[model samples]
Target: MNANLQRVIVLSLLILLMAATRSHVFSHFTPVPDASWAVFFIGGFYLRNWSRWAFPLLMVLAVAIDYAVITNQGMSFWSHYCVSPGYWFLVPAHLAMWVGGFWLRRNYSGASVASLARLAFSFVAATALCHLLAQGGFYWLSNSVAEPTFAGWAKNYGDWFAPYLQGTAMFVTLAALAQVVGEQISRHAHPFARRMKH
Candidate 1:
């Protein structure tokens, strides 16, 4: 019934949901968009203290999930080399998302709803940056594997841009909802769970 405990539980569920959706819902039926960054954003805001540990920890888990899924797809670990160019940009892109979370923490308040909206906006901006960088990375990297012409590479990047945009939009929307869900859980906790002041 502790507020802190409640926040942890809600965040864990969000991370799990994002993971499952990433592998199942998005990989299959429709592009669910990678909402995992939203989980990291929540984790960043959930704690009032050090993100040096929390942000990196969350990122590690996400990478593990990516590795697990990619391995299951029949790619060898070393085969990651094949996509090194794309992964290079992806690393910074993801780090940007976590960094965005850290930035939003400056204005976070458990007692206010608009705080959630602010968080969502920060995430959207970060996601957009991620998409742009990732697209360029993939285009540049994938060329070595297939040796596409410049036009071909540009077309390839353009083709996949929609999915990234959709995923970013979904992530932002879900993150806003997750904030309310976190707040509601906090509300039901014991007396020690008073909303932290800004």
Candidate 2:
């Protein structure tokens, strides 16, 4: 397949998988692992400028899926989300993540060790920023919770930090590794392709 078509298909699948992760798909799993954060990073990394509209569009899809889950799970449409007006802040929260990957996309130098380091740093930094913005925003701004104090919020942030970090790390690392492997395969395949042609 053509590169553009391949990108489209890959991006589409990533978005769908991430979006569905929030729904009833794996609700039974503890903490319910989701790829929401990873999707943003992957989009920025892979889609680059092509992600201009896709980011916002994916955000909407995520919200819609959230609503679907809440309604189906028999909770108030908006209230069940544990969100308040502040939930809208997810836009900028995820934007930071997307920009991180976009930055990496510009700077990444293939499968070199430096490239891996860059991806690792960018992934961790993006996930941290995204988490702080999201969790911190919710703590201070969400009406669903009773007036959370700084200490309380800090404690909450600490409590949730490990899991979020683990999840983001897991997905981003796997993705980066996969990309490296793919690059290696392609690099090696070219010679084989030429030989086959001969």
Per-residue lDDT over 21-96 for candidate 2, one digit per residue giving the tens place of the 0 to 100 score: 7674326355657888888888889888688688888888878887777778778876754567777778888888
Each candidate's TM vs. the true structure?
0.67, 0.90
- Could you tell me which 10 consecutive residues in candidate 2 have the lowest summed lDDT? 23-32
Q: What lDDT tens digits, residue by residue, belong to model 1 across residues 1-198?
A: 686686677567756866776565226346455666556555555643646665666667766776777788788744654356576676677667666776787876774668757765887777667666766686676545466577876676577766665765675566667667867876686445555431
Clashing pairs in 2: none
Prediction 2 TM-score vs. true: 0.90
Which candidate tops lDDT?
2
Shift of residue 175 alpha carbon in model 2, Å = 1.2
